[model samples]
Every structure is written in C-alpha cells, then in structure tokens.
Target chain A: MSYSPPRDRLWFLRRRAYLVFVLRELTSLFVAWSAVYLILLLDAFADGALPAFWDWAGTPWVLALNVVALAAVTFHAVTFLNLAPKATVIRLDGWRVPDFMIVGGNFSAWLAVSALILWVLW
Target chain B: MSPLRRRAEPYLWLLFGGGGVVSALTLPALVLILGVLVPAGVLSRPDLTALLSNAVVRLALVGLVMLALFHAAHRIRFTAEELLGVARWDRFIALTCYGLALTGTVVTASILF
Candidate 1:
C-alpha cells in the first residue's frame, strides 16, 4: 500500500501564512503586467503616439489599476528582499554573515537604486 | 521529469531568480515614474524620451522585459499547475507560458532596436 497526502485546492486559504504565500505567488502577474505596460509605452513612443498613450494611461481607471499594481509590486519587492538572505548566504573572513545583515543590506541597496532612478528621472 | 525539462530546469530557475531580483530592484521605481508620474503629467515628453533614447537605457529595457516575463511565466505555470490542479498538463502549460515570454522578448527587442 502507498500513502499520499491529500490534495486540497483551497489549502492556502486555511492559514494566514499560506494565504500570504499565494498572494505573493500571484504578484508575478502584476510583475508581468508592468513589463507589458512598459513595452506598450515604448511602442507608443516609437510610433510617435506619446500624447495618445498619455491620454489612455491617464484615464481614471487605468491610473487606479496602476496604483493597485504599484502596491502589488511593492509587496513583491519587500517579500523578495526579505527572503534574499536565504538564497544569498555570505561569509566574511570565515565568519558567517547574519541574516539581518543580509536583509538590511538588500533593503539599503534597493533604496539606493530607487533613489538613483528617481534622481535621474526627476 | 522529462529529458527536455531536466535540461532546461536550471536555466528556467535562473531566469526566475534573476528576474525576481531585477524586478524587485527596478519595477517599483519604474511603476512610480511611468505609471504614476507620467500619467499624472509630472514628466515632460522630452524628459522621458531623452531617457529612452539612450542606447544603454534601451538595452536595459530589453533585459528587464525579457527577464521579468520569464519570471512571471515560470511562476504562473507552477501556480496554475498546483492551484488550478492542472499538473497533468504541465508540459503544455509550460510551453504556452514560456512561448508567450519568448514572444514578448522578441517584441520588446524589435521595438527597442
């Protein structure tokens, strides 16, 4: 006889952490959305339709959806950075780097990169 | 695992992980700028175009789009399999997801070039 764990499609809903995990997984869609939206913007820009693109993007509903996407991507970034230490173990002079250091370093780098982009674009 | 998947798994995971890191670092600022600032009329056309016209910027855009799309495709494929109970169609799902990503990559590269 073989034993197997029961499969529950809605198992993620059973726990807060599981729900968060699922939501985190779901953020990939928003990440892809951002990519596709960027591609469209580039296409419009190349085609000399900047004004039209702006008009379409500036509509209330599009702006609202982008705001939600901003939130989702931000959540994804935070979670990804927090989990960075696990994937990126470091050692300095034979001493193991602590997880807090790794997480903090990642967050600091993220802030610096964001600030640099803002400075350049602004 | 199938032989093809076995050979491609590492590369897929690499793209997924790289995309996660790259998008995590860049997407928020991008969304804030183009999605929010530009839409709000805060940025002028010249400012945006000047940035886009840079060769380095165009290259980076291509890289970002390619990696991000692959990342999304890989995650969505697995999520659909587990969450939607479509594991039996794993090969087909993987193909569709990656095919779309590849198409997006080509489109982005062509637009930039």
Candidate 2:
C-alpha cells in the first residue's frame, strides 16, 4: 500500500504564500461588491437621479462599507499586478520579452485607463 | 492534468485571468471615485445617465460585470472548498458559484437593455 500523509485543517496556514493566496482569493468577494456598487451607481442615474440619489448614497454605513471595499480592491489590485507576469507571456520574433517591460506595460495601461476614467468623470 | 479537470479549470482560469486584468484596472479606480471622491463631496456625480446610457459604455459595463462576477465565483468557490475541507461536494459548489455568476450577469444585461 502506498503511504499517505495526514493533513490538518490549518495546513495551508503554515506557509506565508498560502496566507497571501487566501487573502487574494478573498479579494474576489470585494471585487464583486465593487461591481455591485457600480451597478447601483449606473441604475441610480435616472433623469432626476442627482442630488436625491447622491444624498441617498451618503449614509454612514454605505460610506464605511465602500471604504472597506476600496481597501480590499486596492489590496487585490496590488497582488494581481504582481502576479500578472506569472500568468502571461510576451514574445517578440521568437524571443521572450523582459519581465519588467511586461509588468511596466501593465502598470502603464492601468494608469492610462484610470486617467481616462477620471477625465471622463470630472 | 486529467482531461476532466482540464476541461473545467482551463475555461475558468481564462475567465479568471481576463477578469483579473479588467478588475485590477477598473475596480481600484471605481473605489476611488465612488468610495472616496464622491463620498467626500469632492467630485459630484456628473450626467451618469447620459454617459452610461451610451451604447459603448453599456456594452463595456456589461462585460465588466460578467468578468468581475466570474472572477469572484471562481475564487470564492475554490477558497470555500479548500478552507472548509469540502471534497465530495466540489461539483455542486462549482455549479452553485458559476450559476450565481450567470444569474447576476443575466440580471445586469436585462437591466442595461
């Protein structure tokens, strides 16, 4: 019979990477929450959906929830950006591109898109 | 990888990957706008209806929702099973998670169109 190693419930907690992985995984929930907030913002933008809608959204609880979600989103973004190189590959004429360029390109795209959003909104 | 495992995981991973890019870029910006700027009364809500009602914006918004939802589903599904030591109910959990994501996507689409 083959030998089988016993594992505990906290086996994953033994490693630093595992902890980060779990936190990153949990970030997905907040990512979805952020999407939900976006949907609400979109739906609330009716013909007269201005002061009243904005006013309705200015509650303390909503603010707190959003703050928490924002933190989660920020954390998730940082982790995801760092991990992007691992998941993707870039090649030019049968040559593998440098890692920093690939990562920097992602950051540049992120900044450009975010800047566009800011310009559009403001 | 086993064929059965590969079939489900690759597609899920693709969604997860694409979703990761979109979510990483947009979600942070959104949190900044909605959570801090608007809430702090720094940036007021502009003509959001006009902006969102546009065909391109609506399409993009819908796509973002779908991607983000699937990302959450895949992550949450795996995390739950692993953390909870759930082995036998893997398929059921997956279906539930993906099903929820699909339903959310449908609802968002209907509302948009």
Query: Of the candidates shown, which would achieve the greatest lDDT relative to the real structure?
Result: 1
RMSD of each: 1.7, 2.4
Q: What is the alpha-carbon lDDT of model 2 when measured against the actual structure?
A: 0.83
Question: Mind giving the per-residue lDDT tens digits that candidate 1 earns over A1-122?
Answer: 99999888788899999889989989999999999999999999899898899899999988887898899899999999999899888999989999999989889989998998888878
Clashing pairs in 2: none
Q: Write the per-residue lDDT of candidate 1 for residues B67-89, one digit (tens) a residue.
A: 99999999999988878898999
The CA lDDT at B15 in model 1 is 97
Q: Please name the candidate that would achieve the greatest TM-score relative to the true structure.
A: 1
Q: Highest DockQ, which number?
A: 1
- Indicate the TM-score of model 1: 0.94
